[model samples]
Target: MITTVQRPTPADWDSWYTAGWPAVVTDKESESFHRTVQPYPGMTAVDLACGNGQWMRQLTAWGVFVTGYDFSTEALRQARAAGLPDGLSYAQWDIDAEPIPPALMPGSLDLVTCRHALPYLEYARVLTDVGRWLKPSGIFYALVRVADDQDNATAQSDSVLESFHRGFTEAQIDGIGIGWARRTTYRLSARNCGIVLRGYGDSDCQPCDVSS
Candidate 1:
């Protein structure tokens, strides 16, 4: 299990949201997302730590049914105030404090995504739950900051360094042991990266055709 020594509480995130921290999708993140996920009409998806519902909105735009989960009430409020699309919904759930929701049945989900929040989550447990919840052809996608010597050297504060210390190494990701049939990792930037994992039952292990 990936242990997190320190993580932001819901109140901290509420304050951040109140201070206008938008869930801005950067160009690199967009590129990585498009490359990693292919949503079809009627597909079911869940976005973890789905601040402000940016990803849920995007997936719904592509005709997918999306349920966004977040711990911050303020973030969910902002997300709802933005207007939910036909197939989009939001729920408040503190992943660290709670077990996986009973609504997420085994083999029920087509896709699962976590962006910019994996370092704060119990990722091993999350991965196991994702593996159980996903359909045979489902994918688990994650975007996270990378921990490296450069990041450590450039960290602005003790808190920043602590967060960086929680970030994953490429080797760490490879050793996560979710028994995926296929796993692909790619860099989004010098300090950020993404991964795509398919379950053991997924026979179509070929990479997505999208350009890197």
Candidate 2:
């Protein structure tokens, strides 16, 4: 069992949402997210930590069966106001505190997208959870950045491994992408903002098994 570093309570999280963090679900992120998703008309997907349901709207527009989950009521309200497509659904959720519920079955999803959400989670726990939820061929997509990944553990802890995100290898880790996921990365053109994606098998995927 992987244990994630503890974080601010739900109240703190609620406060962040109330301050309008999920206010904008822009086109670039949306397009990047869209590229990661292999949606079909009836394909089932889960958008974890779906702030303002940006991916939900985009996926639904492509004819995917998108269901969104998040921890904040205010964000969910913003999601509702985002004009959800007819094929989309939503539920309130906190992935850190609880396991994926029955409504979100393991190995049942075709895709899972998490944009700007991982910085708030314990990286290892989040990765394993996503692996569990994905089916044999299911794809997992997330947008993580250096800016949103700060925590107090780094300020006081002496462990170098723990101080930095062990998973981040100079802003590249598990991802098999070309472009950087950090906030400061600049793009020469619109198309230059693309990803350097790698493919991993199902939960049983071994480290050397990644094909892309």
Candidate 2 residue-wise lDDT, 111-186, digit = tens: 7777655545665556666555667566666554432224334622565334323122223333432221211232
What TM-score would candidate 1 get against the native?
0.84
- Candidate 1, pairs of clashing residues: none
Compared with the true structure, all predictions reach lDDT values of: 0.75, 0.57
- Alpha-carbon RMSD, each predicted model: 3.7, 7.2
lDDT of 1 by residue, 1-212 (tens): 44445666688678778888554777777766676666678989999999988777877877889899999999999999999779899888989798778888999999998987776777777888888899988988887777754543443245632433346665565564346777777777776777888774455444432223
Q: After superposition, how far is residue 85 of candidate 2 from its true place, in Å?
A: 3.0
Per-candidate TM vs. native?
A: 0.84, 0.67
Model 2: clashing residue pairs?
Answer: 176-196, 176-197, 177-196, 177-197, 178-196
- List the lowest-lDDT window of 10 residues for candidate 1: 203-212
